[model samples]
Target: MNKKTGTAREAPFDLAAEFEGARLAARLFGGESAGSYLVAGRLIRFDRLPVGDLGLLTVGFRITDRPREKWTRRFNQFKYGQPSAVRAATRTLCAAFGMFRLDGDPRVVVVSSVPSGQNVVRNDTPASKLASALAGSRGWEWLPHHVTKDRHPSLTGIASAADRDATVDGKYLAAPIGGEPGLVIVVDDFCTRGATFTDIARAIRESNPGWEIQPVSLAKTERAAYWKGELTNAHIPDYLDAAWRGDPAVASPFF
Candidate 1:
């Protein structure tokens, strides 16, 4: 308690505790499940699973509400080589990967795909850059341009999953053998219908049948209708309370 204000002092943010609370709330309210998910229609297996049950592994930064002005700005900053944004993005990756116990390993390869012939000087491939940084931090190998997009598919404009899948040319998308056989984590910035990731994972697996493949992203659209209900809102205070306590679980993953 603060003597001057005669009220209890607020505690610092606790990441782990907040995460646990969020997990509990999700369980109670029938929200997003925690842990990695097998890519639909793919038989590739992983020796280690990530912390989400969705079709792909993801680190939830925030609810991806459409017209997310803040997220847009941060993504732009990260794309344009802003130091603070890079650090924050890197931290998020570290946190998610760490939670899945993926750090300090040589058996994992982080791969990112970009449009072929894209100008690297103009920072056109932001996801690749982010994936490379994450790999370096984890002491893992990074293939920034493992797969190449033959044509510029406007993924954002494509509404249907089938259309998105049709746009991806598997013949043009290629993943080379990286000398070592291990799990390959395909990293991307955003996931909508997951068509792009699915195509990439398929291409990699077809090329290297011995390697395990999985797709991970920083943010994924919340497609579950249950997330829109009042239960999510009701648990906000609990998450906030856990955050204020500075629980180790709530601590920043970058630290």
Candidate 2:
């Protein structure tokens, strides 16, 4: 979970022990909160709030100024694009999700955002591809983006002048199609404003509103800002608050 660099250096602690603790936290809190805390502590930067031995954890990236380039580069390597740092992180995330067993040979349909025009090598090896590959062991069906090529707002709408149009155009590609509704999970490399996930979720909802679409990713870009000591407690609401305030320069494809 070393952040100075993108390396997911395994901590000396036992993963099973950590998983048990996280499970306990979720049971008491009603969802994946405990697992979220455990993940934030080891992989991403975040703090926890104690409730006896158990506690609520909030991500730490909301208040910090860590650079995204570091993460992007590291993630790039993890995708079979470089040194494979992403594989290590993916394993950690999967373990945290208790997603070890597959119900059947999963027919995986992976939907990825092009982010740039045409199919390039980098996009081919993007985070979605990496996750698809990793999950392939369990019979995943990687479905590519369903929409036409276009630039759409990230769930968080704030876009810098430096943000490239190619990046935006490639996003529409990730939208889930109406016909393929059996997808159990949707993976985005990162989520900040959550616009992308929301769009994909909306598309899924429109096609088959009942489908379960759990958004999973390696890092929450916002987590780098607020992570602090072990005793700090922030809620999911905080992240959503920021999402609501995000800009509209980045338009939603659904809009």
Candidate 3:
């Protein structure tokens, strides 16, 4: 009787279970299990520092209505920005740092490049407002960075002359300003090309030299492409099984 198999001759491989085991494997590695991994299909920890008072600088993007504009008028009234969602996501990210007892009292900085002109750092767009509001609710201070130039996909530099991708244009302009030291986390509503973070990393590494930049998102199209490995039954279970075998490396938490 193979213990890994069931007797019904119809037992399906539990994906959620496999995922959990992998997560446990991550924990065993002394990795700081972030709450962001709770719903994320893939999780990766980029840096581990040994010190006090960590800072999390989040490069943010605007979240817009989905399902195309033709259908937008039907639900525009109910499609306003929701602060609850922003706070929940923020807490999830914060929890990840909290899990490993790394640093809880973090100073979060929200940097935006949505072209809202004016120095409305404290009171500009919804995203900035949400970030400010989060800081207020958590009793943590918020730092806002907003830029407003004639920059977008339609601009001259940053992207290809023939490039029609709006997202890429936004990223190109945003990267220069967002790249900074002290545990930076770049977040977007979704990622299609993975260029924004890459550019940010390039800028930061060029300027600061050794700072590690982590890229995070609310929703990604597929885990396999961005992550190191492909998503498969073998990948998850193999790691988990190796973890349960008391691998020394697995036991070493991220430091």
Candidate 4:
């Protein structure tokens, strides 16, 4: 500790936060191998990271009034600036990542883009907050990029499936890539048709082709909630085969 220079120190990892995350994961997936739900979440595969791809891992299901409903409620609070939910939420997203890190790479970079009027560094959105919390704990580092100048229409209701591709394309323009390449994870609160992941991944991949880009989400819609009421968690297990809440999107990514 440099007393004269007044260097700041990162907060120690909170055991309470870890407990909360484990509790949430257990409640959502189950007590036995809740991390089993963490799959190779490739509803659509962007690329591979290592021989063991980090893949597209996700946890839990999130559609209004469906499985993991309670989680969605907290997620909404997390979205709307609930400061308390950040750490817990982050750990849940990465509840069992140690399972992978033990064998795969431990270095992780979680990135996200925001709506207009927010820059990456100053952004305090839920995803950003979670990323910051994770960075403080593990070797994860938060790269505040993905600067979108325009606020596009949110893909919800009918727009989620109908105009998702049109809405998300070309919106996530990230800054020039610099620094060493680690596992780059582009995160979202929820995913449906993979359009959001595709668009965001497309932008990041273009900027840094060699860097492995992986998409992680807290929840993946079983189907377009607005278009149809049917949502299934079945497709998730097939792709990840070793994942949680069925993170892999077995269906075709494009509509």
Candidate 5:
């Protein structure tokens, strides 16, 4: 505890969580669990431990390898804000972190949002339900926070970087979280370039310093770039660590 501030300091990495989280991610990606997920096309998985200031970010669903193909109708269903689609994606995300054990009464920070193109949009996306489910999970005391909102236009997964940033800039709309800095999980339904997650993380960091933040997205669309070298098990953790630290060798394929 900080004697003066009387708040807990940032907890060190739960190397076990990193090891296990990476293992689970690799397993899911290596296998056919993520239907229509092509390893060749995806770059960042947010499976590694939080690097310096950025937390781990993982998308629940992956964009299909082909433009016409899909993991299922769920992507379309999700765009329509269908509950079943949200639940399925939530389960996938929860499954990924189901075994991740952490310390303290970590708060679940949810960023509920909708696509601008949708005829109908609901604020309570998978993030709300995921937080609820996570509260009962991992045998940890999970506190739910007042939800954040994007209430903005969702991307078509085809926007240029400048355009995407412009559309998403200052849209994070910071919500002050009052508590001792500990652990916070930021959840979103879909991420492209993770602009929302990045913005949200910045807000939380500014308001709640020393808190370990992890961002989880239900789905993400990214450009394709396959790893030419072998990403063997023996080197997963080290490679990820290096990647997070800006190592081109690992970042080339995984980040």
Candidate 6:
């Protein structure tokens, strides 16, 4: 268990067992199978990260109305220029990094999050600030102003797969600026459909195909929340429904 966040550590054995069980259940009951697969050649973790994918991952689940609501509110405060929220997020990230065991002296690079809209400047998002803080704490390199949202294909209100795909395709990624490639960690406060990470991965792969891009968010929505509120055999789905209550089309699928 992670002492700082009071969340259980993602053990390799447990993950493997869970995956095996999921596969077995799928074979027996005709449900969605489980395993680390790729969307645009990037491994996606709807529920949990695979072993060795990334250490000291999420702080908590971001399911709507869950205990993570407080964290989400704090993150929004930081986004809207709250100093205390920034400090809190920084401290939490630092603590999480301490818990993860790094191998050798891996060259860590933090990706700057894209702005919300075309008029907004890059490196101004709250997630970027969190990444900057984490990079500064470990003396790791921080790449800012590297990516930006080219269009305002607002994925906020829409809940259809077609709309989500269109929004994701609208995102633009600038070529990496740093010298050599290393482990690229993209930080975000919340992940609903993972379209942001997917777009970022596609951009990175286009430029530096060999670099490993790991998407680390503070919280992620539960897979079961995407379905009809029934979680008897909950498993992460390829496309998730926008389960947030604030969403105009909460019942719509995110991606």
Model 3 has an lDDT value of 0.35
Q: After superposition, how far is residue 205 of candidate 6 from its true place, in Å?
A: 1.2
Superposed by TM-score, candidate 4 places the C-alpha of residue 149 at a distance from the truth, in angstroms, of 4.6
lDDT of 6 at 157: 79
List the lowest-lDDT window of 10 residues for candidate 2. 49-58
Q: Give the per-residue lDDT of model 4 (tens digit) for 1-255.
A: 668879653233332243355456668766453323322322322122211223345554555555355556655655566655554456555433333332245456767756534434355676665555545555666776644435666556444354666766677776656766655777766655566666666677777666766666666554335533444445433223332233343221210
Q: Write the per-residue lDDT of candidate 5 for residues 147-223, one digit (tens) a residue.
A: 34455565667457767766755655444667666666665555555565666666667767786766656556533
Query: What lDDT does each candidate get?
Result: 0.53, 0.42, 0.35, 0.51, 0.47, 0.53
**If scored against the real structure, what TM-score would every candidate get?**
0.58, 0.46, 0.38, 0.58, 0.56, 0.62
Better of 1 and 3 by TM-score: 1
lDDT of 3 by residue, 59-172 (tens): 121223233322122122222445544433443333322212113333334443232233233354444543444444434434455322243342325344224334333343
* C-alpha lDDT (0 to 100) for residue 113 of candidate 6: 54
Of candidate 6, the 10-residue stretch with the lowest lDDT total is 236-245
After superposition, candidate 4 runs with Cα above 4 Å error: 1-55, 65-68, 79-81, 102-107, 116-121, 146-149, 157-160, 223-255
Task: Output the TM-score of candidate 1.
Answer: 0.58
Tens digit per residue, CA lDDT, model 2, 20-64: 666677778865364245544333321222211212211223222
Off by over 4 Å in 5: 1-55, 59-61, 65-76, 103-123, 138-151, 223-255
* Predicted structure 4: clash tally: 11
Q: What is the C-alpha RMSD, rounded to one decimal, of candidate 3?
A: 14.5
TM-score of 6: 0.62
Candidate 1, residues 59-158, lDDT tens digits: the string is: 4423434334454445455545677666566555554444244323438888875643452212345576568766876677777656665555566677
- lDDT order, best first, reads 6, 1, 4, 5, 2, 3
lDDT of 2 at 126: 54
- State the weakest 10-residue window (summed lDDT) of model 4: 44-53
**Candidate number with the higher TM-score (2 or 5):** 5
Q: Which residue pairs show backbone clashes in model 3?
A: 29-252, 29-253, 30-253, 30-254, 34-96
**Candidate 3 residue spans exceeding 4 A from truth:** 1-143, 146-150, 154-181, 222-255
